[model samples]
Structure formats: structure tokens, C-alpha cells
Target: MSLLRRWFDPIRSRWFFQKPTRQEVLPTEQGLSIYLRLDDVYSYLAVQQLPQLEEILTDDLKPLKVVISDTAAEPPNGMTKTEWHTYCLNDAKILATQHRFSYDEEKPEQPTQEALKQAETILKNTPLTGQNFLYLLEDVFHMLWQQQYGKLRTLFVMASQHQKPQETPERVFDHTPVLASYFEFGGRKYHAVDDLLRLTRRLKQQKLLTDNPIFLINHIEWREHLMSDAEELAEIQAMHPELDLYIALEDPISWLLLAYIKEELADYYNIQMNLYPLSYRSRDHFDWSLATRLSKRAEVEFTPFCRPTADSILEMAHLFYSVPDDEQVDAMYEILKAVWTKGKDFSFKSHFQQMQQLLSIEQLTDVNVAELLARNDALCDQKHQPDFPVLELRINGKHYVFNSLYRVWMIESIFSNVLEQLYKSENDAENNEFEISKE
Candidate 1:
């Protein structure tokens, strides 16, 4: 990241998230509003929390405004639209099971287009506003997600045939996925799922809550169930799913994540990991402030650091590839700590020499740093809307990719999936053995 980009990105985001759409009804200064879509899995999860959110907001001044967005952003994670929706459905199911959200386990994993169409029609016609809209919207989400097409149609017909909506809810949707369904409060935007914890903190900061309330969202925590079953995870590790991580050496979030993988995950899970280093930040898709917040949740130390000069990044990139395969993890982790945690400026001759000697790097001759970064770029390009510190997992011809900066706890979630597969395979094998003995 350039020195200028370090400052400009946040400023640009602040302006972008708060800027009104062309047709947006201007919000009252203190109004709490959200934009939701009928098809978004997370939007369904957000609706489940409204009663709790309302309780938390009881002492506050305004009812939450609901925007029924009509469009969606491109699917993330290099997935086709169908693939992204499928992942969201499965992910939300896990979230529901873990957090006790209302979900119909027997319902289809992905809602059919017919189901979504009924929801859109009903939501478009429902006679409600403020908390009344909140009341009906939950039922709408419930019926749609639970595959209650018959009940949804009844609701839709009842809504369309006899209802008199005093005002129609406007359709204003942005292509940005985060904006597709999010809360706007105190001039800041919060993604309804990942940023739920952050939103609560902001509320407390503004004195909306005098202290921590009885209501808390625990989904952001590392799945405690996954952590409890170390023996199962150890068994699954033998399957050898590979975690390919791409990092931009100068980015602080990369350092923090590297520490978490080493400090928090290394002992508990055994999987082959390959690390690739880049001399530059993955600019466009990167989320900056959110990355810092994620670091806090991961419980890794992070400190603000000067953006490394171009020269320093080049030197470090070359040193990383020069290291033996067995030594790469330690070499990369040390580099991350010195620059990110200690604010060491490897651009300085003294600092550069010290880093080289500390990591036991030998003198370089004809080092091709550009080619190394190009290789990183090629791997990173394999992702859709790729960002620095990308984490990709490959197992049994299936890929699970997590944007580590957005959801640090997702790594745990990934392992949970792995364990589930391993257990099922083991059970099937045992059944086969028993059948053979009987034969």
C-alpha cells in the first residue's frame, strides 16, 4: 500500500457508505435504517434478530426503517450466483443452528425462484411501516426461507387483494454486497452479520447502552463447538486439505492473521499450509477499518505502522522466496511481527541489515522480486474480488474460501465442515465392514 492510499481509502469509504442514492428519501439525522433483499441469506438472519434489537433499542428514539432492495451485487468468492446463494444458505443454516435462530431444517437449502418471487410480491404489497413493517417482514422472511410456498402465496394474496398500503416502499439497491443488506447508524455502515458486534459497540460508544446488555450476538466468536472436538479435528487433518494463504507483506492485517494462524490455530489443527508473499496490497476489494476490528477479535496484537517503502517491500519479498520451504513459515511470521507489531522500518539501511541477520537471510544475487510478486498476483487472481491475506482451502475437489479479514472465526467454521465430512466417511466405512462380515 502506498503512503497516500493508507489515508485515502478510509476517507473514501466514510463518504461512500453515507452518501445518499439518487432516489433515496433523505434520512432524519438520527434515524436507524436498513436495506434488505428477499434473496439474501444474511438478510433472513438479520430479521430473526429484530425483536432483540428492538429490546436493545427500547430506550432509543426511532423505529428502524426497512428498505426492500430490488437488486444484488455480483456474487463474491469467485462463485457463480447459484454457488454463492447455496453457500449462504448452508452458512446461515449453521449460523441458525449455532445461534438458535429460527430455521426449518427440512426446508430446501436454497430457496426456489418461485418462493423468492412470492416474497417479493408480498413485501411489495404489505401494508406496514416502521415496527409494523418489521413485524410483517419477519413472517415474509420466515415463509420464504422455510419453503412455505403455499403459506407465502396465501400471505401474498391476502396482502395484494385486500390490503391498502398508505405508502409504497421504494426500491433502492446498490451493487455492493455489504450495502445490499446493512444498518446505517451514526454516519457509519454496519454489515448486518459480521459487523453486528461492531454495531453494538458503536451503540455503547454513543451511550445508547450504558453498559453491556443481556442481549449479545455470539456468532462472531470462534465456534466453541469446533474448538471442543480436538480429537475429531486431529483425525480429519489426515485428509490433508491444503490452506493456501496469500499476503501483502506491508499490510498490518496480514501480520495479525499470520499470528492467529500460528498462535491460535497451528497447535489445534494439522493441515498443509502454503504461504505466498506479495510486495503490494490488494487494493480494491480490501476492507481497512474492518480488518483492524477483526484483528482485535482474533486477539492478536496490532499496531499502526508506517507503510513500508517500495524498496523495503521488494527486499522482504525476495527474502521470503529465498528461504527454504521448511523455514518459510517462521521467516514470514517474523517479518510480519517486526514490521506490523514493532513498526520497524526496513527501508532504513540499519533496519534492513538487522532484519536480514535476524532471519539469517544470506546475501542475495540476481534476486527476481517482481517475478515472485507476479506469482502471488496469479494465485490471488484466482479469487473473485480478491483481497490481501486471502485464505483458500481445497479438499476432495471442493473449495472453501474465506475472506479472513471479514470473518476470522470462519477458519474454525471451515474445520467444523471438515470434521463433519470425516465423521460421515468413517461411519460409512464401518457400516461396509460390518456388512462384509455378515456376508
Candidate 2:
């Protein structure tokens, strides 16, 4: 391990980072502080689950609603506005179907001020517990997102009577621009279904759950179910499909994902892989360090503390772009591994020489490294993306943008169908059915 890795490994491996003990009591407040925006699709889905979540926790569940700034919500760490919008809608559809929540793709009215006013009225008059507050929240969210204007008019009239007080409720709007629904409990923050599942597990461990059966309706399975049999692999490998991967050298998540692709999916299927080195300025809104830590938590093989400088990132990108088309993927893989796994400084001449040796090349003479960097930068600009490691798999002329490794299964599922169709058409033999194993 490098000095950086050695120093940070123990810190990152702290007890808090590990799975919580059954006896471990959370060290913060007793209730759940949900940060929400009425316009956010994720918020709507999360709110729908609150009734169930509250039923499980009972008195322990003190759900405080904090309305966030909707207009200020930006695309996730490395997504374009268009891409983000598409992803949100698609993800919402899948989640809504799974959770049996109603969702519409059409743009909903901005109900932040109205919802806040109503929430304030409820908090001032009614006790912030039981089904009343939950019902109010559900109604407000449904009215705004689902356009279920059933009792909203009566609720609005009742809310309007309560003078929109000079001092709003203690849990008034905190104007943070959040992209998704998240909960803060005992100093720890939980976002979306996955994080909420973790919180649920912790609560269960603490014996916080009443006799009610806890339903983690939104929990998503992370593992990708792929063919393990030799015959199945051979059959799939016959039909070659293309996987276009867009990566940013500076991103820790990209590094981890690249490593995962190389180790797991590289030879698993007969896919023509096209690697694109994406270049873009880092966003002021995102915390790269936090993302790095999160990536490490997701994949323990990831370097916990290593971060390459801007010049180093550019130099690495130049080397990546300068390589031959066939050698580019391997070259990029090695460069990422050096900085992210091996913790080698990209600025050093020795590291560059090592990378060159790994690439089995004397020097990159075919392309000007500086010019290649400029070209990649321009391509990144043209894409108009704000995030890193955006993977767009084009199958049958249709493009799907998958954000995380968890969604790799969805890609594989689609690939299975595509491969089966191609195989059947070629063979014209219904006798040999290509079974896409879910396990």
C-alpha cells in the first residue's frame, strides 16, 4: 500500500464505516429530518413510503419536513440537465411501479411555497405526530406532483386562515438545492431507498421497530446477475454488442467503475467496448472528496484518500488519448489503477515511463498529446454534461444512460434479450433456447 493509502485505510475502516452492531445506539436525535423539494421525483417517491416507515417505527418516528430550493436543483455530479431529467423520469417510473406509487412524467406545478405554508399551518395547529401530519404531507405531495387536487382546495383555505406567521415552524424551509429526498438522523444522512434501507437495518438492530413488519419497498439489489456457465458465456460471446463507456480520470467513482468493468464484465460478454475520456471542469456544488469516500465505501478495493491534481489529470488524459484505438482501454485502465489503486503520482516521470511500459509502447508519436487533450476536452464540452463517469449503452440505436454499478443488471438484462434474438434469428432453431439466468 502507498503512504496515502496506509494512512487513510485505518481511518476509513473505522467502526462507523462498517455495518452497525445490533446493540449500537445511534448518537443523534430520535426523529427523522427529511429534506425535501415538492418538484423532485425522488422526494415524491420517498414521501409515499413515509406512511409505512412511520408505521414500523411508531413513536420513534418523528418526521420533520424541510422544504428545499427546487429551482436550484442541479443534475447529479456528472450528468447533463437533459440526461438528468430523463434518468429521473425513468428511475421514478421503475420505482413507482415497484412501490405501487402513482407518478406522471408531465411537469408538475412548483408547490414549494404553498406546501410550506400548509405544512406551517399543520405544525402550528396540529401536533406533529400520528396520521394527521403524514396525511397532510401525502396530500400536499400528491396535489403538487400527482395533480390530485381532491381536497387541496379545502386544505388551502384552512391553511390560509392561519397567518403565514412571521416566524415559520422550527422545521421551516432550509433553501439547500437538493436533487433527491434525504433524511438526517442522529448526525448521519440517508438518501433515497438504498440509504433508507441502511437506516432501516440500523433501526431494526436497535430494536426500534414496533411489532409491525417493516417493508423496505424501495430497496434495490446491487449485484449484477450474469451467466456463469461456460456454454452460456460462449453462446452470449457469439453475438457481439457495443458498450460505450464515458470516464473522467479525476473521478474516484469512475476509477472504481472502470476497475469493476475490467474485472467483471470485460470478458463475460462479446461486447465491442468503446472508451471515451470525458473532460470537464469540476462543479462548485459537488464535494469531490465526499464522493471519493462514498466510492471507497462501495468498493473497498478503491483507494480511500488518493486524489490526482489538475495537471496530473490532464497529463493522464493526454497519454490516454494519445494511445492507439485498440490500446486505449488498457492504457486508460492502467493509468486509473496507478493513481487510484497503486496511489502513484501522475506528475512523476517514472510513473509515466511505467505506464508506457504497461502499454507495451516506446512512445506516443502518432498523436500530439496536447492536441489530443484539447480534442477530448472539446468533445466533453460538446456533450454539455456536468458529471463524470456517464455510461451510455447504445443497443439497437436506442441510448440508455446508467449512472451506477447497481444498474448494471438492467444493462445485462437488456443485453440478454438482444443476444437471444440475434442467436435465434441466425440459428433459426427454437430447440436451443438461450436461457438468461436471473441468479
Candidate 3:
């Protein structure tokens, strides 16, 4: 077994939960309204769950009507899944249709030309804070009210993770005279699981509701349940033939449970996942399809990389090549373009040649491991100690010790910077010569 497989073997054992055998629609007594907020890990799952939830709500319960807040009306702060579910219930009472937000043309316009202009002026002049959420909420409510939708029975709001409930007595729950019964739904929280469960229980008890009807959709994380080595995930999979489960785990101590109740479950489930690290915000022209194809491969698995915004590819590029920021950005671009080139997959021998071509390394004479390590050591000595030591390179067949050719990656990046500087320097020289000749 490889290092990756050895690292992931324990994870496969711990996440051995049996998938539910039957397709379960959340059983609800009252009309059902689900508000699923998509965050990083669970966004894909939430999208998948939407069609099922929609079908059930429309075809089965057929509550008074389903209502969804327009994208603009998305809550400024996201609530707990419970809070969100309740919020949606509240919104549903006022608006009709649980589907995505759509315009109602039959309704008369509320603001006249003069009133609209005055409103815009007032909005521009007013200070904004928590009151902004309230203003947005009321704006939607008033619009629906004007159209004679009346307060709805069920409401669903999909808020961003950046937005959430705040601690302000006055600036809370924009809907005045909050709904009698509302259920908020959102993605899973690893750390806040107990808090979330407690909040759900408290809210349900407060409303005198039944058990387990409040749906909380979430993703698995590191440090969940642990399993003994005797228990393999495949053992659990064997028992649950009907259930569709997908698990994409990268850590042994804590597993990321990515159960996709859809196709491609077995392949992704209990597999060691890898995330690509890119420096600088270079995804604009990056080939997502290439990333996707690489991810599907059984050998040398790949997955979309997610690093925090500050440590993103863009930020990393900025960090690595800080001098002459414009040139740094150009170098970042060159690196990404090379990475995205279709034939640059690292699994095959031909791919390295393709990478070399993309990086313009084919023509360079003195690009190898020993030379590169010497250069790296000198740079490290100048900087202080040896933080950025020798470059680690993996070539097909055998290890070829050349200068920074081993540090081909770092070299390519530096070359990118050099290319940008050369362009700028040449341009500057041309302008200076033109001025002198004219004089």
C-alpha cells in the first residue's frame, strides 16, 4: 500500500456507518418547508437534496403554498438550520410557491416615480448596520403584501455562511410579530453539533412540536466517530445495498463524510482524497474539466482544492513573489496556464514533458536538481537559516539530479516573475531611448 492509502485506511474503518436502507422523506405533521443553506462542504449535497424536497413538498404535503425569498432577500446573517427552517416557515406564510424566487407581474407597482426617487434618496442618506437586514426584510414583505400574497405559512431562505444571527435585541427577526410556527434548515456544523441539537430541542419544545421533524442537513468532519480496524467501511456498504452513500475522506483522525445519495457513490466513498494547492487567484482560466477528469482517476486521486481565502492561490502567489506586484501577478498567470494545460497530468511520463513544454523548461540547459539545490541553499543562507531548503522533484523512471530542475516548480515561478520584469524593463528602455533620440 502507498503512503496515502496507509494514511486513509484508518478513516475508512471509522466511517463505517450503515447507510439507511430506504429512501426517507422527512415525515412532517404540518406543511413542510425546508431551508437548506449551502456552505463549502455541504453545498453540493444541499443542491442534490433540493429536487427531492421540492418534489415531496409539491406532490405530497401541498401545504397552503411554498414561498422562497428572492436572492436579494437572502438573510443578511444565516441562522442555525433550525433557525433558518423557522424563518422559512415565516416567509412561506407571506409568499406563495416554495420554488425559487420569481417575479409577480400582475401586482400593481407600489412606488410612484416621485415616491421611488424619494425612497432612493432616503436609502442613500440613511446609515446602515443591523437595520439593513430589517430594511431588506420589510422591503420584500411589503412587496408581497402589495401584491396581496398576505403573510405566507411557509418560508425558505438560503443565506450565505458569512451572514448569521447577531446578538441585538431590537435588530432581530426582521418579520415583526414572528410567525407562530417556523422551521429553519441549514447545513451541518461539526463543532456546534451539540449546540445546534440543543437549540433545535429548545425551539421545538417552545412551540410544543413533535420529535425529530426539524431537519438538519450537515457534512461530516474530522474527529467524528472512531472505528476499530476490524470494521471496514466496505463491511457496512455490503449490508446497505439500497442506500447510496459517498465518503471522500482525507484524514484518519477526523473524516470528511461526503455521502452523496446519488450515482458515483461507491467510487468516491471511503477513498483517500487529495486537494491541489495553487498560489495566487488563478482559477479564472483554470480548466475545471481537467480537474474533474483528474479527480475521477482511481490512481493518484484529485479533488477541488479549498484553502481559506487569505491562503488562497492568489494570496500565495502574492506572498511568494511580492516584489514588483504586477510582474508577480503575471508569473502567477503563467504558472496557472501551465498547470491547466490539458496534457500536464503528473501521473504519466509524457505528462512531465508536456509540463516542461508549457513551462518553457525544454530549452533551458542548466535546469536540474543539484544546481537548483545549490541556488536554493545560497538564497536560504542569504535570507537566514534554511527555511526554503532543497527542491523536491519526482521524475518518471529514475531520479535525475540537476540544478533547480528538481525545483522545477519554484524555477518556473521565478521565471514567470523574470519574464514579467523583462517585459516591463524592455518597455521602459524603449521609452527612454525614444525620449533621448527625439531630444
* Best candidate, TM-score: 1
Q: Which 10 residues in a row give candidate 3 its minimum summed lDDT?
A: 246-255
Model 1: residues >4 Å from true position, as ranges? 1-29, 71-121, 129-132, 143-150, 168-179, 201-242, 282-294, 309-311, 347-350, 365-367, 394-399, 420-439
TM-scores, one per candidate: 0.74, 0.73, 0.20
Best by lDDT: 1
Q: Write the per-residue lDDT of candidate 3 for residues 164-200, one digit (tens) a residue.
A: 4334322222222221222332222211211333334
> Alpha-carbon error at 427 in model 2, in Å?
19
- Per-residue lDDT over 1-439 for candidate 2, one digit per residue giving the tens place of the 0 to 100 score: 2556445644663433354323357754546667776667778777777776766674555444445444447675556777776667677775565556767756633455665555445444543445456666676777766665445656666656753533434345557878777887777777865467667766776777775444554333433444566776676667565777777666667777777666667677766677876553452233443454546544536543356666666668767866788877788888887776666666667777787777776666665665655666666555544455656666665666655544554556666656677777768644444443332
- lDDT scores for all predictions? 0.67, 0.62, 0.29
Model 2 poorest ten-residue lDDT run = 14-23
* Tens-digit per-residue lDDT, 1-439, candidate 1: 4546555544554464344322123233666667788877788888877656755663563566667665788765456876666657666676676567787766546567888877777766665666666767898888887777789888878876887444543323333444236888766678886577767766655656545654334454532434565566666566566777887776777787778777766655665678987656533333545555655667776554455666778877766776788888888888777766555666566767887888787865365778878878787766643345778877656787656566556666666766787679999999999999999
What residue runs in model 2 are displaced by over 4 Å at the alpha carbon?
1-26, 58-87, 97-100, 105-128, 158-177, 205-239, 280-300, 377-386, 404-410, 413-439
lDDT of 3 at 5: 36
